[model samples]
Target chain A: MKHTISVLVENHSGVLSRITGLFSRRGFNIESLAVGPTQDPEVSRITIIADGDEHTVEQIEKQLNKLIEVIKVRTLTKDECFARELMLVKVSCPAEKRSEIMTIAEMTEAKIVDVTLTTVTLEICARYQKLERFIEIVAPYGITELVRTGTIAIQKGSETMDRKK
Target chain B: MKMKACQAMVECLKAENIKVVFGYPGAAICPFYDALMDSGIKHVLVRHEANAGHEASGMARMTGKPAVCVVTSGPGAVNLITAIATAYADSIPIVCITGQVNTDQIGSDVFQEADITGAAEPFVKHSYLVKDPNDIPRVFKEAFYIAGSGRPGPVLIDMPMDVQKAEIDFEYPKKADIRSYKPTLKGNAFQVKRVMAELEKAKKPLICIGGGVFAANAQDEVVKLSHTMNIPVITTMMGISVFSDDDPLFFGMLGSHGVPAANRAVNECDVLFLVGARVGDRAVRTPLALEQTTKILHIDIDPAELGKNIRVDFPLVGDAKNVLTQLLERAKPMQHDEWLAQLESWRVERKFATAKKGTVVPRQFIDKLSRRLPDNTVVVADVGQNQIWTATSFHIGEGGRFMTSGGMGTMGYSLPAAIGAKIADPKRPVIAICGDGSLQMCMMELATAVQNDVRVKLVVMTNKRLGMVRELQTKGYNGRETAVFLDGSPDFIKLAEAYGIRSCRVTDDRSADEAISLLAEYDGIALVEVIVDENEATL
Candidate 1:
């Protein structure tokens, strides 16, 4: 099972390592992670995607909360939050095959960020499942490179995992 | 007033009311030493940076306050890792200051440069790398506060050499108020009521304690709770000295090396109130099985520890003293005479046979030696079988302390820790009990003791081998022993003589009795080397 843990931490230099170090030390499996400054300039929000069962995920949240810099930790389920990951995929497309690849990109709502004589690069930002689908559709065209900014999430409704908690 | 960052660091210590520090100096940290010389605080120069750490740990464990240790960069700071990890494992409060190379040269790996804060991140409660000279006061304040606060542990502050020399307008903070670091002190009222309800319904109730009880200074509250409710108490290895083994309601330590009575009581207890104990594998070999049968209500300052090792039935996150006081206030007079009688029936006392003509039994010697010491004697036990012997055999009377590297089980802990314990309270009797192998590991510290004029008693049970590992080989490895023998070990009596410390070697019952009296009565630092049987066992 995959669990998304949203953590609010002090916006300090070493706070990220404190969270990563804890995950590594406790042997928790981190599938993906993304951190950015939050609404308050002094606080940062880290979205961690970890692979664990119900018990292990609970343990992970408890352990994360132990760090002195961590202000809040909430294990958001897929239903409770909206998640997004921006990915860039470069395909080896000759001039002749450009139209076919462009058609596929247009259907997937991926923007053509860069283009060259021999290759084409498209950028997409969507939920994890949509990103995977885009990659599958573009794989036939021969992907030369692919990179992803691991999942970042926010609450679906007015609820927020901020210092207010 | 404008002052160098290093001077401000010393001022911060003075503000915390620190009287002394243990450290070893090097090039990177010389500036701090220079500033310390005029600060009116005594500095004990430890032989090794590692010993400095252990010594500070000893002080912290004794005083219930965060103690300080300083060392230089690279190897100097690296050497203190063992002691820091040991303190982290046992939840001892210590503020470790290490000097880094020039701020610009830190990552270039210049001479004596090390990323100590990065290296110690996993072991420390929190760490700070002071880039700006003005951050010294705030960092020092936060370091001390974090090190001594809820679920206390070591904290590291790595100061760059250039930063230490930079001048800053000094203004020490009166209090630490980190936004994300507030600890829950009082127990939840509903949870406290829930625990009381469980206590009322439990037929076989048991209370298990750990080092957290001492950290919280809640020994009185725990004892009061036990007596008021007539509930039996058991302890983990770190929880020793909370109650003597002879106390009618006090059961022995639990886990792998624990007594049969305490382990059985844990098995039979319907409600096990675990306070401040981590329930490590050694303390509870099979937590799952016990959780299935027993209702475990765990109260610890660190919420992570509640269900880290076992499945907790009711988890209460708060300081041990405050939560225990809450339970005490809401308690009703109750007794479990039948439960106490059943636990008593399960108790089995071991009787050791007398020592042979020229070989003294280590356990028997410890038993005799402990009886002669004062009620408040501080006993520091090293790792391996010597720790087991002392933990199982030594009787800790009222106000006595039994300090050990329980969680980390590090070797060579006793000698330096005993010296630090003595430094904390000069009037109390402090003793370090170690095996021959463990003694050799820290034997260098005898020079520190003699140089500082710290009168600490040392007892070395010399079997010429690492007895614990040797015993394991004999039992589990087809009796093939390897690397367990101390083939080139120096005679401890002669070593003590070289250090100009009074010492004795006991070989038999008569000599053991005489040496015990001599070591106990000696006003100066002393060592007693007792030759034991090669195959002596630990229970």
Candidate 2:
């Protein structure tokens, strides 16, 4: 099952390695991860999407809690969280098909970040599936550059993600 | 004052007053090596990283402090897994710091790029990966707090190359913020009153003390409570020195090698007041005897530990010292001179007579050694027969200590742990006594003594076999020995000699006396190898 892990860590060096290390050691595979600064200057929030055993995820959350630099950690399952990913894609399109691709981009509300003769780049931010479907629509345009910020998320309510009874 | 990152790290270590560290350094940890060159901190370089972790765990077990170790990343950190788990299982406080790839190159899969925090997560109480030099001190502070507080266990910190090389203004944070961490300080007063009420109403009241008494630094508190309450105190392996064995109210150790009267008393007692020690398999052999005959009042630091192995009629959570001191304030100090006299009679009926084999028994040798030891002498014992000898026969007078890895019962804890404990309080004499099997497990640590010039006496009873297992077989098995005997034991004297430590081999009573005399006169680490019959069981 897929679960989302939110980590609050001290803003410092090697913090990323620490977080990633936690995933591997606890036997949880990180399918996606997004790290960025939070309102608290000293702290950063890392949102990671992992797939593995329920017990393994529970353990990963605990391992994350052990790091001194990590202030707090919570794991939110797919059913209990609002999650999204951001992607920027550059694609090759014939002059005749440019308008047709633009229509599809409009339908997905993807922004045009860059454009050149025979190439059109669209920036899309949405749920992972939405990004994938948008990519599939644009796949016909001959792919070029594909960059993405892995899944970032927050739980639906005032939940502290401790499932142990 | 500007200092190197490594130097600041060492200063932070010194601030914790951690005098001993167990590790095998490499190119990756060269910065730490440079800082260690002229520092006062004693570093015990083990043959392997796992041994370092094991040694650190041993030290923590002995000192009730968070022991430290350094290992380079990748294989070095990975090598420490089993020992880390040992600390976790036993809740020994240890801080493991490993080298890491530079911050920028960490996920780039640069040279020696291994996820140390990830690898150590499951086996540790906590872990950190420091990418910024600025956070090093902060992480160090938090690591110690987490590892040594709440429930003690191992904590790992992976310092990347840049962080280890980078420097910033440094000052040890005088305090730590652990809003998430709040350990139980005192038990509920009402509950303690209830226990007192029960005690007031009970006829046969018994006390079982665990390692918590020592861990909580409540030795005197426990002794006071036992004597004042007039309850017979039976200690588990970890609870060995909470009260002296010869005290008026002291019942010898309980469990497998327990006095028959103590075990029988466990059956007769109407109320069992267990402080700090859990009712483990060795302490409570069968459910029929322990199930319903006695009302149990369980008190421990960790809430999860209450009723974990056995059911509890009353449970309290907090530091043992606080719990005990508070219990004294509210408890009625019942005078049970009649009950005490009955116990004294039982003691006489089941007194363990020192086997009068012309050959010196291990217990007698340890007793002689203890007598010659100084007032502040610290003795570390290996598990198996040696622990039985130390717990039952050896005496710890005021100002002395008896330390062992009892809860974990890990073999080979003596030598390296002795180095760490001796370093912790150098003025106090430290000696390690081990069985042949356990000494072999961590004997490489004798070199650890030589490397740092730490003086801790190392004594091994060489039976040329796994004597404990063989003894168990004799008691429980049908006389068939399986993988018990060592074809030919290595010369431990020569092994200690390789480490530049003074050593000797003693076989008979005269030689044993000479060995004890030499132990008192020696100025540095000494290895005394005593030859003993494999057939003799510890009890």
Candidate 2, residues A113-137: lDDT per residue as tens digits? Answer: 8778889988889988899888888
Task: Label model 2 with its docking quality class.
Answer: incorrect
- In candidate 2, position B425 carries an lDDT of 75
Each candidate: how many clashes? Answer: 0, 5
Interface RMSD of each: 1.0, 5.1
Best by DockQ: 1
- Would you give me the overall lDDT of model 2? 0.78
Stretches of model 2 off by over 4 angstroms after superposition:
A1-165, B1-4, B38-44, B54-63, B103-114, B167-171, B287-289, B348-359, B472-478, B497-500
Per-model RMSD to reference: 1.3, 7.8
lDDT of 2 at B441: 81
Write candidate 2's Cα lDDT for B81-154 as tens digits.
76788777667799998887777887786676787776666677777777678877788998898888766889
Residue B24 CA displacement from its true place in model 1, Å: 0.4
lDDT by residue (B77-168, candidate 1, tens digit) is 99999999999999999999998998888789788777788888889988898999999998899999999998899999998889999999
